[model samples]
Target: MKQLIKNLCYPLIAVLLFSACGEEDKSISAPEIVGAKLVSFGFYVEDNEGVLDKDYVVDGPIVGSDIEMKIPSKIDKSSLIARFTTSEDNPAVTVKGTVQVSQQTANDFSIPVDFVLTNNSQNNRKYTVRIKRPIEWVKKVRFSEFQLSDAILKVNPVDDVPYVMGITNASNSENRKTVLLKYENETWSMVGDTISNGRPSDIDFTFNSTGTPYVVYTDYTNTIPQTATVQYYDGSSWVVIGRNYNDVRVSYNSICFDAMGKLYVFSMNNAAGGVVGRRLMNISTYNGGSWTTNQTMPGRNYNTYNMRSILKKDILYLGVYDYANDKGTISVYINQNGVWTTLAQGMRMDGATEINYNDLDMDVDNQGNIYIMGLERFDSGYKLVNHKYTASTSSWSIFATPIDLIGNTKYFSIGLNPDGGLSTVYNNLTTNSNSSFVTIDKESQTWTSPFIFPDILNTKADMAFASDGTGYIIYIDASKHLAIWEYIEDNE
Candidate 1:
């Protein structure tokens, strides 16, 4: 009986030893394995049928250790669910030390997030998931106070709020006066008295660095063979800046401030004794006290249509049209040490040559790249184009996809945004299409589909940037009233 008890004890001990081994963690003896990998990743809509305009459900394969998903503009990124799968069975996925369940966890994906995955064999892998949401630019009105009879002559953007010049005398029956308007407190109101107190013909407005408004204009009612005049806003009243009127029959005139805050006015005056051109193009500069004649531009013959002069990098850029030499060539002159030099030879726009008066606009980027906005003639229709000239290479090329952005336009304005992107304010002459503002980055070849206007036409459309790099589209509306729309980003 004792021998039998001893054998039973040995069997019982064997069972007890096996139970003790089971109590130990099995993972401690786990074998090394090949690393697990991320198989797929996605974010799906809960109520896919009714929540959004369309299903934004994005699910895709993982490439290497990276994953990405693109969403529509204005979509919220703070609260997003990331559903993913792994290659191995019983895999454990964690983000910032928190265990994750497939399609069951919400995360803040405003920026890129990293994830770590572990498989049953204790193998691990890491991945980075990024969400790409395109920016949404919105357009809102900044000014709305205008009478049907009031004519919006020009809009000049200052630091934050802008200033606009208008004609209170819209018709010949009334006494005409140039009025100065200010955009402040979300609306446009009169800042001071009338500018010229006469009927202004050609108008250009700008603000100096010290926040003083200056206007260079031609008044036909007050003076015969109208002279180009400059005016400034002096706290309480609008007064003429310099009394040095050349009286050489100034017609097309513009105003610009130099790097030193000195004001310069360029005008198309009648041919004088020493000046060149069929119409003498004169450059007049104003010292703080008085205005003085600077010099006449060379090679100013046979060019009739005068665009505007813009200063970039302290260099004066003047644009004009030349028909005698080339096929509607756009002549751009840069003042280098007081000598005018031609840039990129001259760009051509065949369609503009046929018209006696055309609206061909020019703007320069911070990089000193010149851009001329005009129309190219085609058998089907006139296609809007932006002819770009690179200052570094001295080469000219048409921007990609202008036809798709503005379609066939009768008039348009092309300007570079502060972010180095190209933007257009175009009159869409397409039968069923509306006017729009399309912005395309310098690197991207295609457009991203932008703001659409309400029945904006071949009316005066100008694109300007505000102090904070915000873009504004200024145009004459259907009622012949001035309209300003600004671009704002919408992030949901």
Candidate 2:
């Protein structure tokens, strides 16, 4: 009995030892990684999807050039599934599930198998990184001829209030005279003579400080060859400025009232030359009670024909044409410090033979800088031309290159603003299409491309630029209607 008991004790002790050994080997360890999450996408490379660091490795051909994940040998073996989903709206790719092997002691395992990847959906992938392409330039607001009344024939006597006033014909027959139609307080009224029947050379209306009205026009109403008749608005009717005709044989004139309510009129008079057949400028001053006239332009034969006069900052800028040879010439006479001085000249095309009377144009800025635009005969055909005058050096420079901005057309008008910018309106003779508008940046010496008008045969147009650089194009509509198109911003 004692021997049997000893044998049992030994066997029991051996079993206990084996149990202790097994527990030692089963100590708890760090959890094995079973899957990966998509951390982020990498740089733009061909066919690259975002790297997955959290999802289980499902397929053999892992998407990117990098690894998915690894597994520990201690974890229970199961099917590892990885899902690749697209983020954008693409129809070519399909999301599929696959299983991949996770090796123990391996850093990150790549699926050895290869599968076709459609980048059509890869572009759809939402990445934290994105790029935007640059935008191209767009041509907006263009110029068109608004109206070409007989009044606009005298150089540039046309001035529209922009909002309410526009150009209209005084006569409706085969011979139409240009006149100004003004709308004040919602009422349309004729400001100047429609017929200008007596060959009224220049008609200018001015506003008093208190907003009263005054006018100056050349008429033969009182004299035989017709003296320049001056009229003033006394709140109701038109009254002559003085008791007698002050300006006689006035060729061209401009009227303006100063801050003190004083009336001033500058004009060109047919001069008897120390040499004959010359022209001189006569300036008239009027207070509320009296009138006076004096010769303002003193030079002899300075080509004062087709003179355009403007007042800026209490000074007068007279744009005289150099028609001594029939071609166009623009000489700027500036009134400064109580004396008149020749400020600048836009004379680049003077030597060109093809330039004609109808082709000449000129405008003066508030600083007396002259801007001249015209059509020049090029290659036996007329082409658009542009030039500028520098006030400091009294020099002229060509502001347009290639001359295609205004297109190859005839009978166009040029408009200039206080800034050096200019605009041109011309009939697109080829298509007889609507007019084309061209704008030039005198500072940058660049031109925007032609913006074609949308109408057809809107000819005999006139244009004017305002202080804000906004302009008006007045033209006679096809229905014989007066049309005004303006440049405005497009919200779209």
Candidate 3:
């Protein structure tokens, strides 16, 4: 009996030894990350039907300390989701913040992500991922023409063709005629016949979705009482838009088209007196059928001067200069849903007591942000001020002046850029020179160094941008010829 008990005890002792050896082998050790990779990255893009899922993968396996990604230009990069893989299973991967990638306000940006691996041990390995975008601007094409006045250039939003409108000297007669030139095959050619019925005073144009061009211009025909008639080019011939009233004078005739191909014309009228006064602003709309008569806007008092308007999405914004209270004032109005509501009225200069508001120009961005540029006479000198209206907050704030002393500026023109910013050009009367073409950086709320044209003495400068963020500038050169500077991207 004693021998049998010893044998059972020996077997039990052997089993206990095997269990101890297994526990020692299962002891935890430090985890290692031999490799890390971004599997698939994408976001949910909103579409007309619904949300569409867009997925993008890395070019290669993420093997080193850095990973690079390229985002398309002008893309709305907000709310991104990423899938990743690590050397070990179920590794922890996290982006730095609530990752929302957006290039709307900025030209480029960089984002960082982190990955950690662990295997029941205190020591762990981390890997960093970097994403970036690179962009640069290059000068592309320069085109020139001689003996052109009042030169205006516009790009077809559909086909990216450029159209130039100006007044040229008649070949035989001394009278000047209106000419429309289009850029094709790397050369400029006349679109139609040279309009010679009346002298072209002011002109404006817009394009339809299918790249059709429409233009409106004031024809100051040599007649008794001097009736200035408003005419429009209906893709063929110039036809009168409104009736030729007696002694009717139209100035600053601005025309724009909305998203629905509806045309709107804003101009200041003076009848009977045969004088051009910056007051008495009138709006005319063409509802894809026929042109309407002068629809008087609401705040047309005797003291109103320098009225300008711009249309965006179905909203009409009017900026008016009012001197009713002996001091110059600037007011902004909006016409939405057939109701003319005053968004801002009687806005006088905040710093100086006596202010002379000289010129007023208005523009709206794709995001519905409003910008009004005003040239005011202060105690020091002529100052240019920009008032920006934030649509989200429904408020206005004064932007920092790019140039304190405008030096008797004239021919002020402002337009929204393709990258959701603003570009302004003007002629300096005091210096007898043209100011540098200046642009507002929307993301930084700052002005870029004035871009000087190659020909310094250019006049009547106008600026426009294509849908792909390309910029074009047209002006009458020192030789009285039309010239254009194209801003292109250097992708290479």
Best by lDDT: 1
Off by over 4 Å in 1: 1-145, 148-158, 270-280, 325-327, 336-339, 349-357, 378-380, 402-410, 431-433, 441-443
Off-target runs (Cα >4 Å) in candidate 2 are 1-160, 163-180, 183-214, 242-250, 256-291, 294-296, 359-368, 376-380, 392-394, 402-410, 416-420, 428-434, 441-444, 454-459, 467-469, 478-481
In the range 1-492, model 1's lDDT, one tens digit per residue, is 999999999999998898788876545655644657777777767533232343444355556776766665456767677666678475788999999887677778767788988887777888877765444444455445543333333334435665667665356623666777765556667878677655666677767776687887776544444667788888898777654366555666778776666677877665454343445467888877877784666655555455577767777777765445435556677875556787743455444433223566777888888887666555555566677889899878876654632334455676665656777766665534556677774334666565667656556566766545556666666666667676644333
Over 4 Å off, model 3: 1-146, 169-174, 184-186, 208-210, 222-236, 239-247, 257-262, 271-278, 285-294, 302-307, 322-328, 352-359, 426-434, 441-443
Clashes of each: 0, 18, 1
Candidates arranged by TM-score, highest first = 1, 3, 2
lDDT-best of 1 and 3: 1
In model 1, state the lDDT of residue 458: 53
Native-to-model Cα distance after best TM-score fit, residue 393 in candidate 1, in Å: 2.4
| RMSD of model 1 against the true structure | 15.8
| CA-lDDT, candidates in order | 0.64, 0.50, 0.61
* True-structure RMSD, every candidate: 15.8, 24.8, 15.3
Whole-model lDDT for model 1 versus the true structure?
0.64
Tens-digit lDDT track of model 3 for 354-383: 335455677787777888777766777777
lDDT computed for candidate 2: 0.50
Candidate 1, residue 200: Cα displacement in angstroms equals: 0.8
